[model samples]
Target chain A: MKIMHCPLNGPRNISEFAYGGQVEVMPDPHQCSDKDWASYVFYEKNAIGVVKEWWQHSPSSYWFIAERHNASDDILRTYDPSELFSERVDFTTGENEP
Target chain B: MTTGLVSPKRCADSHGDRHNDGLKLHDLSLATRSGVRGVKASEWLIAQSLHQELKTHELQPPELQPNTLVELPGSRLLMALSTREFWLLEPETEAQASPIPSGHCAPGVWPLYNQNSHAWLVLSGEPRAEMMAKLCGVDLRIEAFPVGTVAQTQMALASVVIAHHLWRDEAVFSLFVDQSLADFAWEALQDAMEEFNSVQ
Candidate 1:
């Protein structure tokens, strides 16, 4: 059986979890242009390598992040959102465009 | 105060089904239950001296380990759902008393949620785990899920909060589920238990 190690619940059947999509650091709407804001809402990268994304354990209703490779769909690891940051901070995107 | 909210329609009493005593399902409709959640929940407990053992000065206070329940020698049971979350189950014999302050509120602090609308069910018997295997993905074997272990997980395609306790040799599992989906959950659980009943 496929298992996803919940930071709280330990290794559990992946069925107990729901994919919560990618965790993107939102840009400040006041600083971004209409086009950037629209793209942020509409566009999602179909990138192949490792991706950090949100996942929820339905039983506990706890949300956390899982690092996985897109091509393989193999989850590298899962950790609580608190482990990364207690509060939100911007992820540094390579592009200067906010 | 919240406990006298509503009288539950006991599914087992209504169904009147005959089952082997070795494995039986019961509707715990009469159980008085409540939810405690918020950032300062643990703090409030400590301040009130409800559960001072949970006091932590760490930046990331550890969660109350899963599958555990808090009880004094003769006090009510408190299931720790997480670090700042709990489910308090009151006895049916006693009038529901507010454990926290009447207006247990503060600006952006520990807020209380009354969970009186949910349905409580109990599945107890020697074959309880065998029956649960059909519905849940979690391991319910006694060694893995010892008494006092609580888990909030999926059961019978519905969200459920479960606590394992033993009544002598019989394994008792308590379930709390959303009231809106209680009937659906009950039917699904009954189906899970039927095959086991037949086999035994």
Candidate 2:
């Protein structure tokens, strides 16, 4: 069985992980066009080269990021999301508007 | 504090041979356990513990690292699931009070419903790791997962937190799983332990 290294729990069976879609910049829901919002939620780059993606360790329910090659199916490196996200994102919505 | 709590695994107490080299299983669901989680959970717990120590004039417990278990006063076990999540376990003590609802215990620390949401099971014996191999993927041998080690992994297709620590000087594996799956996990463990039953 294949093994995948988790940012929290070390290497575990591939079965213990669920592949989340590739990491992408989100368009502001209230500021961006409807088309842009839909594309951001439904679409992926799906390129052939190495890309960053989100992965969850089912047992611990921990989510982290992983760099992997699409064609070779090789995991380049894995790390905690804190490395990329330094601050929390706050969305200004109609209900919370001052 | 006595809440007259009952364990989900009724057969746990009746089972298990605690003698050295004998495979045993005990159900500790009725034991006292509580948890906290949040970015400031660790800091808050440490502060609270220190406050209690001062009030009682007792020594405070040591610092805990991720995936590690530390012994505390009154036979309590402090297990760190992550830097921000921790479980305080009193395996020998029965539940006295009702579970606290989910809410802020401190500024950024929130209480967990683990006392009510999870069942506790403990396994002991010389070949405990071998028995676990039948149901789990992690290496649980004492050398690999030494005493005081904690692992959050899957056993018998169910999520479980396994803590290896010394109980009364004897090594044991303490498992925590969802209360709803207590019987299933217990039965699965019993089945894997059948071969060692004769050794007891």
Using lDDT as the measure, the top candidate is: 2
lDDT per residue for candidate 2 within A1-98, as digits (tens), equals 88999978898888888888888888877788989988988988777899999999987888899999999999999999999888767775556699
TM, chain A, every candidate: 0.77, 0.90
Q: Model 1, range B53-125, lDDT digits (tens) per residue?
A: 3333221123456447754323356677777676666634343455554554553244434344577777777
When summed lDDT is taken over every stretch of 10 residues in candidate 1 chain A, the lowest stretch is A88-97
Report the number of the highest-DockQ candidate: 2
Q: Which parts of model 2 have CA positions greater than 4 angstroms off?
A: A91-98, B1-20, B50-63, B97-99
TM-scores vs. true structure, each candidate: 0.79, 0.88
Chain B TM-scores across candidates:
0.74, 0.84
Docking class of 2: medium
* Model number 2 iRMSD: 0.8
